[model samples]
Target: MRIRKVIPGDARPARSAPGGEEAARDPQFVEAIARGFTILEAFTTRDSMLGNQEIAERSGLPRPTISRLTHTLTRLGYLEYLPRFAKYQLGIAAVALGQLALANMAVRGVARPLMEALSQRLGASVSLGRRDRLSMLYVEHAQPASAVALQLGLGSRLPLAVTAMGRAYYAVAQAEERAAIDQQIEERFPERWARVRDALHEAVDMHAALGFTISIGDWNREVHAAGAAIILPDGGIAAFNCGAPAFMLDRDRVLREAGPGVSEMARRVLSIASGKG
Candidate 1:
């Protein structure tokens, strides 16, 4: 099977203006820590075991820097080195940290039941996601009871430039943030940017007009999806999408039926999260 490629967006942490000014004045900011974390982040679910050169390519760090960071990370128990493959993978500490983060997120509990119900009703897969840097990170997923359903699961990350959930997120994002992300998309995906640009804008407009966004064979040629977003009481934005094979879920049906259902489900989830329902 040919695996689909998900182009990752720029995930470098933005420097805080105040902190940057302070660091410039104080000269105590540990740049090494940030670089080390960047090296660690280069390993993803798709690119789990990476050698120094691959790590350098993915993280945009120099080869020498990556070597040192990997060594340090391996020694610190944040990464494990595989001698046979000459690669490194995230260690137990990273798994523990991920588990801690997931345990603290209350939204999963609030949304899972509703997502399962919606998945069953529509015979599609329902997923809840949040913005993770420049990607939509799947936080929860529910699939229909049917034997055949999309297999996207929690921890799957999709590009912010093409996916329905990503477009819904862009629709709700602040204007300045959206502009920054758009510029990055244009720079990173110049070849495909022209094609995706129009579709992305259309999805945003559709979201504004219909309270949901639809994409048919845009992200993945075999899949069709619709998404809706809601702002939680804690001020974080979350999006839910329903997706299935394009042959099974036609565009018209998605726009007319699944779209509205997904949008209403998102609203109800938001209401419950905000203590209003």
Candidate 2:
């Protein structure tokens, strides 16, 4: 689904995405290139290294195909192969591309200082991210010097079905966009969505009323966060969240402190991005 704009109480109406040839529907779609990218993406935060068999299982491609793709990706500098472990992880080329993309994001430059200030004040980590197909990919972040702080940062992916950031983005998504995401959720994570459906709906409504949403022990049982979203000048929603481990922040403190902190930072970001600040 195309991105949509959402703001508290005053967002402009969303427009439908212009018609374009989608991958599944396009005759000119390159399956081999897509498969290669899929192989690279199979490496997640949990599994930084994976052999051909592991990549095949995660990517749903044949072992021979994975071997070919891995070899090509490694040769092209997108994946680094470890000889002793006989495994592959993302390589410098991939890191270069990701850094290039993040470096060019104007909003991130405007958000980082705000995030750092908030993180310092709350002793929590503040992150700015946008939706990356079925996950929220942190593009920038700030963390306090707390021992209990989550170590996730740039390139880290959070589950889109249950995390506070994902919920806030879903809360702000235009109706048609939300419907598209709901369909994807059912298709990609049916049982997980079923379990969180009611709570998600409630959180969306709370975002409507309070300009923030909470996720206490939903994504990570030890992590607690409050989330809010901002509509960029290009009409895309960027999700930002603040939180720490359960030992550092209880539910009541998250509601009273982190909720408002994240919401205020989101507003500040929107203001700057819109040239109003």
Candidate 3:
């Protein structure tokens, strides 16, 4: 295979620059992309629908900069400006991008069988995840064929401080990284952080002792989970987890039945990552 070098002055035909300068040389265009993403991120749980001023305040960009970014994003169909309410919201383009990304995950092929086997053997919800910042994005999930089952699927994102899998991942992280994650969680989600921080320290220590992390009703009420992490080549944490309704399975049962398989699968993934497969 031959590698093609990117010429410094190359430009894409669809989006032409004013001169023959390469796209990388345009600092103004770079800033525009940054400001646009910042504007989008400004709309969070606390402020879902935001006006230009709110977006500016949250993003720390000037009001005029936010207004221009919003206009560009709205024009690109990534944002919708509500003229009647004078607010901006995420539009269909974002949903379309999410759908496209999920479609490419190959969850059914790679993870479904493993999760199904784990679920049936343990009589629980077995989930595989890829960590994303403070969240765990589900790669696959398999639940028992019970009527009162959790409806989580491949695309669901679980908070790191709130889910067993998330804690397991954090426990496997280095001390410094875990501390940084802890600080961010405490700073960002202070309410939940206050309730869980002390227990989380104990949980981290317990994971070191027990070789896994367990949580009961941490993320979802009445949901019990035991989880372990698979350390990837780049030191990112992926996880395997099993959850059940509190009355259905206890921590001992989860560890005894589900822990081995999850850990074995994690080892297999790590081994493959290490080029041993």
Candidate 4:
């Protein structure tokens, strides 16, 4: 897995940076670092282990370049090379960094206790998360002791296009960011987007009207959830989601109880984060 050290002033054979034309004009944009992240992102929950060739195909980078980057990442503990399968998975260092990032989020500390009380009172699961690409990555959650259907816990990613949490984030995102997100999602899911596009907009409009959104059996056929977004101290959007099994919470409860509950939770989170509470 180890490779020779990258020499000083090494020449880049293919400087294929992403972000299309915008990234091309940026003088300060570093391709080497960006390429490493692209490789890291090539592995998903379903494809947790990937060989160099698979990494290249997913990242749209050259195979040789993928090998070099994977070797470097393996050495740096950002990727773990599994000789048994001739593939690689994210390593402990990457996990540590993700955990550290979540730990440093002051809002998690402020939100989790409130989320716990809400979960208990509502008899559902409450989560706090932020957008990670086209997904919502849960940083913290509280589940009621009576048992829940969803197995999602910390670090679980919920798709942005379908889930309540994702809709809340999209609802709160600026216009430019929303357009970019829409383009990426459409590119990745062209066939599905044709069917989902109108509904997604409807949800966004609902959020605008009510300050929260609902997703009933969208992400999972048996789950019902609602999400509300709040602006964080860093000007980023994080959402609070409350949900239970579809049988436990019908459409009415999701709109009446879950939706407003998440909205209130978001306001409380914003108040504490902004030092107004």
| Residue pairs of candidate 2 with colliding backbone atoms | none
TM-score of each: 0.83, 0.86, 0.64, 0.80
Give the clashing pairs for model 1.
Answer: none
The 10-residue segment with the lowest total lDDT in model 2: 6-15
**Model 1 per-residue lDDT tens digits across residues 119-154:** 999888899988876688888999777666665677
Which residue ranges in model 3 land beyond 4 Å of their true spot?
A: 1-71, 79-112, 189-195, 275-277
lDDT for each residue of candidate 3 in 1-277, tens digit (9 for 90 to 100)? 4222211111111111112232355645555566566576555433457898777666677667677788889999989989888999888997698677767654334556666877787667788887766677776678766544555655566777778888888878888888888876776668878677876776688677876777777676667788888666665666878877767766677667666666665666566666786
- Go through the candidates in order and give the C-alpha RMSD of each one to the true structure: 5.2, 8.9, 12.8, 9.1
Error of 2 at 234 (Å): 1.1
Highest-scoring model, TM-score: 2
Per-residue accuracy of model 2 over 194-270 as CA lDDT, tens digit each: 77677778878999999999999987788889999977889899999997888788999999999999999999999
In order, the Cα lDDT scores of the candidates are 0.80, 0.81, 0.68, 0.81
Give the TM-score comparing model 1 with the true structure, all chains together.
0.83
Superior by TM-score: candidate 1 or candidate 3: 1
The CA-based lDDT of model 2 is what?
0.81
lDDT tens readout by residue for model 4, 79-172? 9989999999999989899888987898999998899988988888899888877778888988777644455677667778788888888888
The TM-score of candidate 4 is 0.80
Regions of model 2 farther than 4 Å from truth: 1-29
